[model samples]
Target: MDDLGVTVSAGSYRSTDPEAVHFPHRWSDEGVAVQAAFTGAHLLHLSAAGCVLNDVYREAQRLGVAVAGVRVSATGDFDTDTWVSRGITYSVEVDSPAGADDVAGVLEAVDQVAEIPRAIRAGATVRRVPAAGQE
Candidate 1:
């Protein structure tokens, strides 16, 4: 779907010292709750992983597949000195009564719908711009 694209409401309110930021995100498309923790990189990864898992489970349910026996696990491999992720190993194991082929098909479909997996497989480019008086 997403004919109109996803809609979300997010805002960040930080204190005067700017030591920390309180960020909140809401799903405006369906009045759902989406949360984000304003911590560092590690916490951000956990939040992103949790969002991906929820997205996968929701898609499976919409396709009439049972995900009660599903297990999702993820780990991060990163170098702090370089401040980059070497890789993220994530997997999903489904224990449905369906046959092996069926389970595989369902997982494939889920992966197709989840955004994070697609982004991971096909890299994205980012260009940073300096703010008005920063440079």
Candidate 2:
């Protein structure tokens, strides 16, 4: 991921920034940390990154793999003329004491099971409904 990327990390790599916003998690006591700006493009990548981070922990536990931390970063570009996405690319990292093959297995499972990434891969139906009492 480059400068235009967004990252979400949790567990051992979770942010300690005073200004960082954290979201509640079922697996971690400190929650998840977000390391991106407030923008549409960042938000789009963030959804993928955050989902990956969460899935790493979820899938690890389900597989009985010990994951101490997780980080996911995603980046994308757009066609300036149409503002259509050029697609997003993402990466994942996990800190664990488990065997390499175990960690790899968990990562593979997460890749197949993460919901946001699947939704994006299948394309999305985005629509704007009229605001209350406005239509």
Identify the candidate with maximal lDDT.
2
Question: What RMSD does each model have against the real structure?
Answer: 11.4, 1.9
Please write out the lDDT profile of model 1 over residues 1-135, one tens digit for every residue. Answer: 101111111111112233332233231122222223343544535444545555645665676765444434555655757866665555655556667777677777876777775666576565899999998
Q: List the residue pairs that clash in candidate 1.
A: none
All candidates: TM-score: 0.52, 0.92
lDDT of 2 by residue, 87-110 (tens): 989998889999999999998998
Candidate 2 local lDDT, residue 69:
84
**Model 1 whole-model lDDT (C-alpha atoms):** 0.49
